[model samples]
Target chain A: MDFLLHIIIMACLTLFPLLGYNIVFGKGKILHFGQEAQSLMAVYTLWVLVVQFQQPFLLALLASLLTTTMLSLLLAQLSFRLEPDGFGVMSIALHLAVLSIILNWQSVTRGALGIPRIPRGILPSSLERYALVVVLGAIAWYFFLRRLERSSFGRNLVALSEHEWHAESLGISRKKVHTIAFLLAGTGSMISAILFPPYIFLLSPLDYNFQHMIFFVMCAVAGGPGSLRGVTLAIFLIIFLREGLRFMGLPADILGPVQIMSFGLILFVAVCVRRDTLFPKQRTV
Target chain B: MPILSLANIGLTIQGHHILNGVSFDVEEGEVVGLIGPNGSGKTTLFNVLSGFLKPTEGSVTFREDDITHLIPSKRAQLGVGRVFQHFGIFREMTLEDNVRVALEAMPKELRNDMGTMEETVRATLEMATLLSHAKQKAGSLSGGQMRLLEIARTLKSGKELFLLDEPTAGVSPKMTHQVADIIGALKKEKKTVLIIEHDLPFIAQICDRVVVLDVGQVVLSGKPDEVKKSKELQEVYFGADPTT
Candidate 1:
């Protein structure tokens, strides 16, 4: 039962970033690739506040989320002038820059040694209760996103993503919508940043790298970028696949490559078989 | 005063003169057809009026206000709506959502005057003959239906000046008639329109005035019948010698 709860918690953790990516890239069409940067910023901010500054856990969580959101807004504004491909490339570059800073800034981030022994910060100690809380939170987030999809702001995002000039012609401010999307996505990822690291009792720059970024994007695409239910399912499937591989007798080195290969193959087939339904590309009329 | 006036509009990009000395005026409630051959700067002129492109030389006046340097969304807020040659309706959203987005994007005062959002969305879809498909994804709509949806959404957003770029392009004859009827309805509602069209007879059938452009210049402007009968229009469209 505890193991099942652990798997569920892991899926929930994965779901947070996928949901965040969905808001910006899937709906607003910003092509943001800075999820890892945002996550890392939030995690480190929380760690610095709680461990070094001796701030209260709850206060640190809020401050970290606030800091990440502000940085995301700034990043979004910087990338607003770029075309979609440029926007994506710029985000990746920024992510790598942030990663480098985290890795090299030894005095502040403690460098590659990482921060260990984090507190729970108002969360339930029992695994089952924590899983229940996370599951409930995920469910709430799913419904909130669904409601948002039907809201006026949501319509603006959809319109911008579908046809930018048309949306602008209708008085939908592309920059405003995209900036808000970035802010919302960053806040979404902050949940996992707050919960996941403490659950594992570690905050490491190595954990939030390009590979994890790619994993989140792959899960988002496989689930269908705009569909919350699809993303939820995709996360579980990918998580189960990874966890299942761990149960096998393969060596660690072999297991890593095999897992990545399986993800690529599954994503390729999903895209091929469900191309029309997966992302629902706007057909030019 | 004219509802829209373009005074000596010129646009040069990367040393290429796309438009030059293109001047015209559209009066209140008038449906003006801007007819020109391919590469004749009709769409570029529309882009300038819609605030998508800035004319390097001249100014655009809408309702006595100069909007030459306004951003597209600000221009939209000032009641300049454009229907693209390529349809602008959000295809991934439902038909209702396509309209709802346009309505909701408007300024609060304008949006409020339109009554409830639900009713407005329904009415807008109904105007486009698309109420039945309100819940359906707009991508499933035919090309003609999408054009009508875009025009109807624009109209319902309370735009005073409509810039329609080839509303009949890619539309069937039956849908063409429907588009014409929608423009006629806009005319009755006292909305001003500047339309770019390739179909001469369609222009004659609907437009009160015609402005013919060729190679970035306005070659002729008059009543539809007069412009249709003018020799310079023949020379511009057919490349016939004016003397002949």
Candidate 2:
């Protein structure tokens, strides 16, 4: 039961960030740099308020959301203004910037030492409670994303992805659409952040670095970038594989290497075998 | 009134002059054909008119407003619609969704209050004679169907000024007539159209007047018969005299 609960928690943790990034940057055939940074900032924001300021859960969540959103908007403006050849580069730069901030500002982040003993109300002692929390979180996220995808705004994002020039020609402002996509991504990351501390009982700079960025990207890629189901399945498979490998007597030191190798292999295979299925080309109208 | 005008427009890319001092005007309710050989700046002029490329010199005015520096979308907002040489229909989306997107992109005031996506899509498809394939993914459509889909989307935009680049380029001969019919429909609606066509017969059938371009300059502008008779125009298009 404990093992199952752990798997569920890990799955949700992995799935949320992958889905969040894919929801916005994924659509544009261009990735944005700030998604991972925004996620890390969200975690830090919540950690600071809940641990330092001793804020209530609801207030901390709200504050984290607001800060992350503002940061995302700022990053979008900066990243979009300068021409980065692709979203992958932008994401790497932003992730490094956040890492630098977290590392340098030891007072706020406690740096690599991490914030331990994170209080998990009601669910910390029981596997059942943890499972319930995971189920509830997944439901909330699924519905929220579904609502957005079905809305008028969602259609516009898909349009922008399909043909940004055509969308602009039709009078839809690219900047506004891109900003909205970033905001949605930020919101998803913040919600995930609030849920994360309770599961792991810690927040660290290592939690939001390039390694995790690649993990999230792999989940999105494996699941299929433009598809929700693909991303969800990818998150589950990746987490399952990681835990399975760890259980097979692999040392902690080699875990990161294993993850990188497996992710690369899977992504390469997926791209080569099912290029059309995984990353179906979109025509511009 | 002349809905759109281009004066002495010139465009150079990577040290190659693609369009040089080419100019023309399209009045409201007129369907003007821009005919030329391959690499004769017909499509380049369309690109400039649609605001996809900035002219190195001269100006573009629409509805008496100078829109020389306006971006593509801004020009689209002011009633400029462009159909590319390659069909630009979103392949992943359904035909209905494609038209709906165009309609939704229009300013709120311009959209029909009573029109749902299904209704707008159906209407546009009917106009283009493609109602049967409304639910099919646009990428799955044949070249002719894709062209029809593109024209349907343009019409759904409700824009008066249309820039169609090689509307029948890849389409079958049978589908060419269908495209011609759609252009006729645009004429009946009193829309201003600038068509770039290599098919002389297609241009001759629909165009009120034709402009011929060679090496990025307008070598002739007159009725189709008059332009067809020009020795230089024939030489530019056919490379030699038929008598020879």
Candidate 3:
């Protein structure tokens, strides 16, 4: 049962943010790499609010989500019409800039030394007590995305993905659909960020880098685009694969490389099975 | 009065003139057919009017509204519907879904009622005789059926003006007749239509006016019989000298 909780907790962590990116990805086929940036940016905001200003927890949480949403919308504005390749490049660049600021801002972020024991938890329990609650939150998020997938808004996203000109000609606004997707994606990242501190006790710049970005993207892609169930399966499978590796007690040096290599291997097999189209192309961003 | 008009429209790309001073007017409820040989700029004009391209030298006005700067979606929302030469049906979706997408953009009063939306979708599909295939994915249809689906989508999009670009490009004679019947139905409701077609008889049966373009110029415009009798149209279409 404890082992089950561990898997449930880790998989649940990735699912909320995955759904956020999946909204745009399912219809647009653009794998946004900046979600990690938004989450880390949220973390920085939460720490400053709770630690620096000594504000109440709820206010800090609200501010953090709002900041991430705005940042996401700003990114969307910059690369609105770019194709998948250009959008990917732009997202990675933006993420790096945010990561750099968080790493170098010693006065505000405490630099690479890390922030310790910032207050976390909404329920009464032990420090690592809310894995089941997190699982519930993930389930709620999954059902929400599933509902969205069948709604008019969801249909428009899919139509936009299939053919932009036709969708627009039928009166679907590309800007409106994309804006909504990005905003939702930002909110998804914030949920994961807010749920993060309770388990991670220590915060470091390393947590806000390209590695997490890849993990976030892979969590969505390996599930298959435009599929809610596919994503659900992918989340647990990836978490299990990585955690199972840790449980085996490999040497620390090879553990990191091996986890990454295993992903590459699965992705390679996926490509061979589905053809070199792991990420399908979108006409425009 | 003219519902949609273009004045002095010119498109120059990389120093080559794609369309040169093309002017025309489509009056309310009038069906106009634009015919041109390859490279004569029919599709370019469609692209320009549909908000896919901005002309270098002129403007587009719809219902007295200057819409030269509106994007494609804005133009669509303002009652301009297009059926592409390559068809615009979302092939992966069911036929019902395709029609539903167009009707999904219908005015709030009609769309808010589930029963009305269903009836609207059903009626639109039945017009093209595609009601039986409503549940199937469009990609599985034959080219002719796909063309019918495209027409059905454009029919229910709630747009007052229809741009039918080659409605019978790659279909059988029977399917072509069905398309003509569909256009006749639209006319009965008093919707304006502009068709880009190659079939002269088809144009005669539907269009009230014919505009023949050649090498980026409107060389002839008249009733179908008058345009067909003109030497200039024959010369442009056949590449033969008018006097000869």
Candidate 4:
């Protein structure tokens, strides 16, 4: 039961970035491949402020949110200036650049060794209470995204995704909508970054690598882009499925590869099965 | 002063001149027809006026504001609306939502002047005669109906200048008449329209004046009847000589 609770907590933690990604890439049609960088920067900023500068927890969290949002906005600006294909390549490049900085900034980040023993700020330190807070936050975030999807702004986003030039001719500013999307995407990761470091009691470079970025993208794609319910269900499904593999009696070294393989397999099947949903289209006769 | 002025517009892309020295003026409430041979740069001129493609030389002045280098969205905000030759309707959205999106995107002052959102959407759909299909996705709409929906949506989008590219293209005769009636109504409302079309009779029926293009240049411009009977137009459409 404790193990099951742990999986649930982790799944909810993962929802933060996934929901953020859906708003930008799924709804806005921005090929933002820098999800990993946003998440890494959020946590790193928090760590630098709380651990190194000795700031208040809330203050550090606010600063982390602002910093990450700025990073996302900068990336959005670059994405705007390039074609879709170029933007995709640029986002990946930016993600790698951020990873390189985190990996090599040994003096501040402590490099690959990572910072351990992160303190739980202002929240209940008990595992059960922390789980409750995280779970509640996830539920609220899901509804928040749903509300956003239904708002006038959200409707504008859907219209833009369907046909960008048409939406523009209606006076919808593509740049404005896309900028807000990146802001929200960054905020989603900030929530996770705030909750995650305290929960894991460590901030490691490995946690914010390209593999985790792919996990977020896979969840968004396999679950069905632009559907909050689909993405949320996918998060829980992938997390539980990964945990379920633990009882397979596989060796520890091989287990990690097997888990990633399962993700790819699930993604493949989901793409095949939900082709219509994966790509939003007009109904056919 | 004319509501829209295109002065010496020239667009050269990759060493190919799409539009050269294309100049015209559209006064307020004027429904001008832009007719040309298939590759005579009619659509390219519309693209430049709508800010889709920037002209290499010359300027676009709309309501006295020089918008030559402005982006498409900014042009839209300044009351320049375009109905594409290809349908621009958001197919996955409901008919009501299609109109609603445009209304919602209008400038705040204009949106406010137009009553509530729900009323505006209904009225816009009513203009297109698609109010009954307000709940239906626009993809379910027939081709002619889609054109009507897009035109109606643009009509109510608070735009002072409308650039319509082949509005009647691929539409049925009955739907084409309905489209003509909509343009008639737009003129009555004193809205400025520059329409690109191949349907000469339809253009003659609605347009007060016509501009003819041949090989990226305005070969003729005059009253519809005069343009229809011109030797240059005959030569442009058919290689027929004036003696024949």
What DockQ class does candidate 2 belong to? acceptable
DockQ, candidate 1, comes to 0.68
For model 2 the TM-score comes to: 0.91
lDDT of every predicted structure (CA atoms): 0.86, 0.79, 0.82, 0.88
TM-score of each: 0.95, 0.91, 0.95, 0.97
lDDT, residue B44, candidate 4: 82
Query: Model 1 Cα displacement at A24 (Å)?
Result: 1.3
Candidate 2 error regions (>4 Å)? A53-63, A78-87, A120-127, A277-285, B238-244
Cα lDDT tens digits for candidate 3, B78-162: 8899998887878768888888878876656546654677888898888878899889988799888989888877877778899
Using Cα atoms, each model's DockQ against the true complex is 0.68, 0.46, 0.56, 0.54
lDDT tens digits by residue: candidate 3, A1-285: 777777888788778877788777655665577877877778788777887678888898888977887898876775577766788888889899888888788888888877877655564355246786787898899888889877878878777777888788888888888888888888887887777665666667786678877776666667776678987898899889988999788999999999999887776665466443454333321
* Model 3 misplacement above 4 A: A127-129, A275-285, B109-115, B241-243
Candidate 1, A96-190: lDDT as tens digits? 99889988988878888888887776888889888988898888877888888778889898787777778899998887888888887887778
What tens-digit string does per-residue lDDT give for candidate 4 at A123-212?
788778888999999999999989988887898998888878788888889889888898899988899888888888898989888888
Candidates sorted by DockQ, descending order? 1, 3, 4, 2
**What are the RMSD figures for all models against the true structure?**
2.1, 2.8, 2.3, 2.2
Task: Sort all candidates by lDDT, best to worst.
Answer: 4, 1, 3, 2
Candidates in order, interface RMSD in Å: 2.3, 2.7, 3.6, 4.8
